[model samples]
Target: MRMILMGLGVVGRSFLRTLIEKSPELRLKYGLNPTLVAVADSSSAVQDERGLDPKEILDLKVRKGSLSGHAREVGMRGVELIRGVDAEVLIDVTPSNFKTGEPSLSYIKAALNTGKHVITASKGPFALEMPALIEMFQESGLHLLFSGTVGGGVPFVRFVRKCLIGERVLAIKGVLNGTTNYILTRMEAGLSFESALREAPGTGLR
Candidate 1:
């Protein structure tokens, strides 16, 4: 399977690194070969139709802190990357704009239209446009997966989907936001709200 990563932000870069390190084991378990085809950011991107070197992509991200140094075979806007790439999978890592869902929606819609299965971390598509996106994906015969939205890396979604297959999940609840839990902990443990909020990483409440 070939993949195109549409963002070079902190989470996107980190996920790529993790996948690269564990890809051999993953391939063995899934009985499939996975390849990273393209890496795109707001400013620039690296595209090699054959496949991108995961190590090189990681190194470039480390050195530049974004995908700016790589050669740009396509000069259109970053959003167009999803439409033009030939990869079977498009990973939409663009930051979610809850207000309008501008770029994220545009990218997701374009990828679905182009017949690529999309796995997105963007909140707008899942949180707000889920029903419409579900219909679109079903109509197009593609998948629009948003595993990163609800659990925020807690494995809650996978647990519910895989383990609770037959069980009816009437309602779901969680301390889904790690920042909320941490802040509450600090406050209960006798720390200031300012300090607790400050402790949140560069991504803030996310």
Candidate 2:
């Protein structure tokens, strides 16, 4: 799939790295080939029709604060980068603001308006504008997938939609914040939440 990625934060970076690591297995097993044509962070955008090098992307992120440090320098923010790319799908893993879903909502709407499929992990747009966004998708016959919205890669949405197709659903509930859960779990085992977060792998709360 030719695609554009809209976020380059920790979650986005981890997704990209995992995609590269599991790509060989993915191609062998599912016949999936995800080529990133463009990527954008908060500051800048970068695009190459031929696809970008994963190593180069990570290296740039490490050396520079954002993807804009790439020599090409597309000079666009999130939504502008969405329009500038020739991608068929957009992956949005930006941070979510439950109060007012500004930029990410706008990004998803613009992508759908341009007839591009969207898969978003950010909770802001989906939670605040689900009715409108779903209506847009249904009317346009396009996809607005949000499997990553609730459980990261747990496929919670897919499981419910596919497994409960004909069943009457009442309610579903589960822990959404892994960090807080981890800290609490450790606290139950006699360590303070802060101590647990400090020792947790890749946790920022420490």
- What overall lDDT goes with each candidate model? 0.78, 0.81
- Look at candidate 1 and give me any clashing residue pairs: none
RMSD of candidate 2 to true structure, Å:
2.7
Worst 10 residues of 2 by lDDT: 197-206
Off by over 4 Å in 1: 165-173, 182-191, 201-205
Q: Positional deviation of 71 in candidate 2, in angstroms?
A: 2.3
- Of the candidates shown, which would achieve the greatest lDDT relative to the real structure? 2
Tens-place lDDT per residue, model 1, 1-206, is: 88988877867878778888888998889877778777877677778778888788878877977777576445656557767778888888888788877677888888877888988778876667888888989888898788776656566667887999999879866678766887888899999999878876565245
- The alpha-carbon deviation from the true structure for residue 110 of candidate 1, after best TM-score superposition, in angstroms, is 0.8
Candidate 2 local lDDT, 155-185, one digit each (tens): 8888888999999999867765666677788
Cα RMSD, each candidate:
2.6, 2.7
Candidate number of the best TM-score:
2
Q: Give the TM-score of candidate 2.
A: 0.87
